[model samples]
Target: MRLARQRAHALIAKSPADAVRSVFDLMENLPEVERLRPSEVGLVLVRGRVGGEGERFNLGELPVARAALRIPEGPVGVGYVAGRNRDHAELAALADAMVQADVWRDRLEEGVLAPLAAGLAERKADTGRKAAATKVDFFTMVRTRGEK
Candidate 1:
């Protein structure tokens, strides 16, 4: 689920206007929404553990944008995405709210999430193909006792 959200964030961040357009296309109207926390950019400390299981160390700071909003009389949703795109953050926030709304979940998932997932899958497959193109195979030679 986190990976799906991350993918959604990546898709939104890639093109916020498109995401907004898609959202509007899917839903005729949105309930009155209030920003619990307006979209803002900040740095988060990234911690890592050696080999996935060791003492944690501060890796670095990553720039992130986050937004929290709620539909009046409905669930509050939060969006946390990499980079500083306020529009992306806001749209993601809306999607999050819709996801929690249940009523809007199917529409959102079908119209927004599905397309983004498809595009992401396409890009990933393209990358894999390119990587495979450059793949090399190495063979080791075996010597007999009399071989020079």
Candidate 2:
């Protein structure tokens, strides 16, 4: 279920709030969920390293949205997604709680996670191809002094 939660969080961050609605809409049996902490948007400090191993520093502040929900029939779930879309956060937390429930785990992964993963991979590959097109290489050729 931990893997599902991670996938749900990533999908929520990568995809738009509207994307999640279609998945739930397709389901004939939707589980009841309570919003323990209705989705809220706020700012958080994003930390980073200058060169992957340099001193850590506050990169910048980024707007984030988060939600907390509980399945009265199961466990409470929390979701922290990038961007300030309240609906995305809410849906992510709902997915998190649903994944915790055994019956819904596989269905949610297939209906939601799999498609999102595919789209994300596609986007990444496209970006990589574009970057590779402009890639540059440099080499140094040492020349020893010779009499001519």
Candidate 3:
């Protein structure tokens, strides 16, 4: 996934004007890719700043967007987006990693990784809520006969 994201990012950084479309296009053509449900994806708009040794500038924030891609028969969603700034490549790699991982379906690649990659702190606290609830405890519980 990281490789995929990097690919996406490089594609975008090389062509900022068509970054978003390029990402969507690549995902759309990926083999066996499953399109995420519309309700499963979320987006957030944010503002931030970039500070240098001599000056701090307000980098106007655009909507940092994300989409969920459902993996086949897997209880995971891949979150992704083409974000603002020159870190498009890094964000793409992070998104790809999240998507390929098993435990990160609910994660927002666009909101978190994008901003972090761009060297800005996240301005919003809204993480997307899960549409469905599931519980899985990795720890094993031991029981004695009398405990029942």
Q: What's model 3's lDDT at 70?
A: 46
For all candidates, the clash counts are 0, 0, 2
lDDT scores of the candidates, listed in order: 0.76, 0.81, 0.41
Give the per-residue lDDT digits (tens) of candidate 1, residues 68-117.
89986487878877877777777888877776775877777778877876
Q: Which residue runs does candidate 3 get wrong by more than 4 Å?
A: 1-4, 12-51, 54-57, 73-148
106-137 per-residue lDDT for model 3 (tens digits)? 34345333434343212122222332234455
Candidate 3 vs. true structure, TM-score: 0.30
The candidate maximizing TM-score is 2
The number of the candidate with the highest lDDT is: 2
In angstroms, how far off is 77's CA in candidate 1? 0.7
Two-way TM-score contest, 1 vs 3, winner:
1
Point out the worst 10-residue segment of candidate 3 by lDDT.
120-129
What RMSD, rounded to one decimal, does every model reach? 3.4, 2.4, 20.0
lDDT of 2 at 103: 79
TM-score of each: 0.80, 0.83, 0.30
